[model samples]
Target: MKKSISVLAATLFLLIMVSSASAARFSIGGFGGLNLPIAQDDASSGALFGAKGRILLLPFLGLEPNFCFAKYGGKDVDDVRGKSYTQEGGDITSFGADLVFGSMSSMGKMRVYGLAGLNSNTYKREKLEDESGLGVAFGTGFEFFPQEMLSLEIRAKYHAIKVGDGGKVHLEFSGGLNYYFGTE
Candidate 1:
């Protein structure tokens, strides 16, 4: 009985070490693209940029922390007596986390992934007070690896923010490159 227990413990330790060594390492990257306003015709699409860090726990699973900033196209605000006045638009900043599902292709050079997560958005308006809300985010993207430590990816994300009168959603499309380090 004692011998069996020792053998089992040794086997478990080996498995853990092997798994850790084989796991994919953490990666940090930044992306920039378009942020389009959806459902609300009042706002126009503009530039968007963000940064994110990814921790891949397994070949098919990862956790990502993200930060993004976006601008809305400028437009005239509160025209008094139809007189030309000021241009007003809003900017948005978002912080979020996502769970990513990924796998390599049959040939093993490319990786495709999908992500879903929750985000908090702060809306800074030109003529109004700032408002903040929590929203749901989901997206899909594909990565192509040209080397062991570098890759390129393009992704599209849909974020829906809850408000007093129902809610609004934004659709963002972006592309970026990443450098991976540490693990295989």
Candidate 2:
């Protein structure tokens, strides 16, 4: 886990350094929204929050580095005797990078983009041991620029992680704001 994080950090640093020279635009943003579990009986829907930075390496390609935290909702279950119990929820902390493909120049004030990424996720629960896993994520988003320096954005993403012999999958819907740092 430590080694993976170290490598991810080094790669991000190198990308940022390279982007400083050839990138046409840069932005930083924060987001919050819903985290909905898919086909999972042990957990329910919860919340998600994150921060991200983007570097446009070309007119149609960009890179995003991000960190996020998400929570699972507790589930209510019944034993064979028909007694009910509430299961404890879990949370995940993730760090990843995405390759974004889109035209920076927009039609009117809006731009549409798609992204795919790899992430390292740390999952924690009340009674279970903490586990770390590598995950994949894919998403699409709309960005609305209200002014030269600010953008309003909304996105929907699918994330999947494998742990032990099973896996977890979720859908994340989010809204955010970004402040640009370079010429767009």
Candidate 3:
């Protein structure tokens, strides 16, 4: 019995080490693209930009932390005659984390990820004041490494939230390059 227990413990330890060794990566990247607002009274699609840092826990899994800023113009606010119009616009900032999955291969890395985080939006129109909410984000992208030290990727994300009576959902997308300053 004692011998069996010892063998089991050693086997488990070995397996853990091997798995850890197979799934380790770290990267930093940035993105910029467009945000298309849906089911909203203002703004069509806006420009967005952001940065991110990632740490791979397993070769196929990683944790990514990112922040984005976006601005849109085209909503109507309170007019000169004390009437509200829908011709004004606004800016929004989002900070979030994503549990990333997919393989990093020599042909380039492909990933599908889910995001959960917070967002703060400020509107230029008085009727659409600033608001904040806990949001859910999901997106996918790929990285192509032309050089060992640099990579490029383009991704699209969906951000949605339920706030009081004015909930919002938007499609966010970006394309950016990354520079790996440290050793691989």
Candidate 4:
């Protein structure tokens, strides 16, 4: 926990320093949504929440550091021996950076973008050891800036964690509000 806190603090400081100097565009936001599991027969839909720091390097390019947590819904099943078993939901936490493309639509009130990045993911399950590994994440989003410094955003994200023989793939649909600082 201490190590994670330290890394988060350092990352925030670096982002602030870089953004302050550039004075281009900087924002902080948080989101929550549904985490839907695909191809993983044993897993079910879950709750997802996350936060991000966004730094726009150019009008059409940006960098985002994000953290997310998702919890799976519970399931019950019986083994091959016909023994009943209660299966609890699982959870995952991920931290990562993304490269974003596109921004500020022609209408001037909307921003649409796509992001892809690498993440450090940790998976936890009931009655099982926790697993940690690297993953890839990709997402698309649209934000509407109704006010000068505020935006309402909607996004869908996909993650592929390399843990099992192949990988664990999941998708998340979410909404958030962001507060921007600095100039355009």
Q: How much is the lDDT of residue 93 in candidate 2?
A: 90
- The 10 consecutive residues of candidate 1 with the worst lDDT sum are 1-10
* TM-score, structure 2 vs. true: 0.93
Q: All candidates' lDDT scores?
A: 0.74, 0.88, 0.64, 0.81
Q: Pick the candidate with the highest lDDT.
A: 2
Model 1, runs deviating above 4 Å:
1-24, 75-87, 104-107
When sorted by lDDT, best at the front, the candidate numbers are 2, 4, 1, 3
* CA displacement after TM-score superposition, residue 107 of candidate 4 (Å): 8.2
Score residue 142 of candidate 3 by CA lDDT: 65
**Model 1 Cα displacement at 89 (Å)?**
3.1
Worst ten in a row by lDDT for model 4: 1-10
Q: Write the per-residue lDDT of candidate 2 for residues 131-159, one digit (tens) a residue.
A: 99878899999999898789999999999
Regions of candidate 4 where Cα sits further than 4 Å from its true position: 1-20, 78-84, 104-107
Query: Taking the tens digit of each residue's C-alpha lDDT, what string does model 4 give over 1-184?
Result: 3464466557656765775676566789999999998877678899999999888766777778889998887766767598866578799998877777896323378888998876778889978998877778899999998987899999998988876556889998999999988666
Which candidate comes out best when scored by TM-score? 2
